[model samples]
Target: MISRIVRWAAQLVILAGIAAFIGALSVAPAFTYRPADMAFIRINFTHGAPRAECWRPTQAELTKLPPSQRRPNDCPRERPAIVLRFELDGVVLLDESLPPSGLSRDSPSPIYRGFSVAPGPHRLHLAMRDNPRTKEYDYTSDFDVMLSPQQNLVIGFDPRSGGFRIR
Candidate 1:
């Protein structure tokens, strides 16, 4: 009688502990993704330019080819790979060479990345070169930023606006 009651009470405690352990496991990832006292900076953009080696055919060159062989001046559907660089407080953080997107490499390459940093003021340097001919970056931006804990700063490009923008 007394033994039966003790055994049931012990089984109930064990079952409750198992349930609590599973619940904690489910919530652990959520907390890790948004830890306290850290700010995140997001950089995302889609940019590409025509490959420098792809050239337009002159009239003489065009006439020598068949009608099917002759294409428009800008008919090349491929673009050059893009080079990206990011610096924080004069230290290099991210440097990547991204290939163009699309089934045929005709579309703009997209980049989406994030960096975690302590909340404070820092100098940021960003540069990107979509063109392959020149060794210089087509777009460069440098500025000082102040960030708060748990904040997110997003940077992206606007083609119509003709430059990178931050928000």
Candidate 2:
């Protein structure tokens, strides 16, 4: 009876020590994504660039091609690179071009970028040129946003809906 009582007491003490250690860990601040006063900006999108105009085959070219493989107006499957520019407040954040993906270089380009910044009123500028013909940005948007601490801002694009969307 005495040995059993002593074992129970020891087990209770060990359990209490573990509980206190866990409680202390729970009260300590350790893990954090970003600084307490910082905010986040992310731009992610996939877009297909416009292909160049198709060309019709000449008589000589048609004769050279196999009968089953001959095409009158052969269109190009390769697309151009995608141009993107981003400006935050009055400063430029990003300005670069991204090439198309896939083995044939005919697939949509995927882009993802992130930035950490101070929280408050900010001016967001976004622009993209998906067409080879256009000299300037084919799509553009500007917004004034108020960001709180640890807030996340995401920018997206969809050509069918006319481009840039913010969330």
Candidate 3:
């Protein structure tokens, strides 16, 4: 009877070990899992103008405007000479290239585009190019953004008087 009980206990232990091994395998894939709803941010310049030519603004031009006249916070009193296309997740989502020529003081129309995201933790980084005319300036801005599930996100560029603002 003693030998028989010991054998039964050993068998139980082996079965429990197998169950644990299978459970670990099933959970392992979740650790490396990335959601399928990932999206990318893109910029499209209107009229095929080079990014450099379209976004370059002289310091003198920026200084002439009142603080509130700048972009991201204020729509251009005059429509931008250039149009910018913004997209998310590879779709042609926003076409802001042909905005109306005039805007009121309070209308800070967003010039940047945004994308919807699923719930999960995310990271965003800004990428830009400096205009030779204004070494301190970025003529084009790129962003690498990540989002978690059920997260609602909006991303856009504001040419704040030729400076880049991402929100």
Candidate 4:
């Protein structure tokens, strides 16, 4: 009978100790997102454009390739590198060049970038160049954005619309 009482007492003590440990975690140290004034900016897109215009294949050139593999127009396998620039309130935040993807270098180039800034109204300028031979930008946009605390801003490219979309 004494042993049985002792075992029950030990179990109750252990349960109480566990409950106390859990209760301590609720108040002693606090954790938060840590900051309330920082906002985020993200750029992500995958784009594809020819470095130069395609041309009709000459009769002699077409004859060189196998009959099944010959194409009506001859296009280069290598695409131009993608150049992107981002500016905020006249301060340049990012400028980068990305090479073409795929083994044959004919695929779209993918880009993903991020930045942190204070939450407020700011001017944003964005430009991109997909043609290596051209000195002009293929796409450009300038606008103002009002960011909120902890807001996530995303800029994506849509060739169908011919520019970047902010979300």
Error of 4 at 147 (Å): 0.8
Which residue pairs overlap in candidate 3's backbone? Answer: 112-156, 112-157, 118-148, 118-149, 118-150, 119-148, 119-149, 119-150, 120-148, 120-149
Error of 1 at 143 (Å): 1.9
Worst 10 residues of 3 by lDDT: 44-53
How high a TM-score does candidate 1 get? 0.72
Ranking by TM-score: 2, 4, 1, 3
Please state every model's RMSD to the true fold in angstroms.
Answer: 3.7, 3.1, 15.6, 3.8
Best by TM-score: 2
For candidate 3, what is the lDDT?
Answer: 0.45
Q: Name the 10 consecutive residues with the lowest summed lDDT in model 1.
A: 27-36
- Cα TM-score per model: 0.72, 0.76, 0.30, 0.74
Where does model 1 exceed 4 Å of error?
1-30, 51-67, 70-74
Better of 2 and 3 by lDDT: 2
Pairwise TM-score winner, candidates 1 and 4: 4
- Model 2, 81-101: lDDT tens digits are 989999999799999898999
Error of 1 at 12 (Å): 12
- Once fitted onto the true fold, the runs of candidate 2 whose alpha carbons sit more than 4 angstroms away are 1-29, 63-69
Q: Per-residue alpha-carbon lDDT of model 1 for 17-115, expressed as tens digits?
A: 999999989877664666579998899888876565657888889999998988757356688788889999999998888999999887888999999
At residue 134, give the lDDT of candidate 4.
Answer: 82
- The per-model lDDT (C-alpha) reads 0.85, 0.91, 0.45, 0.88
Better of 1 and 4 by lDDT: 4
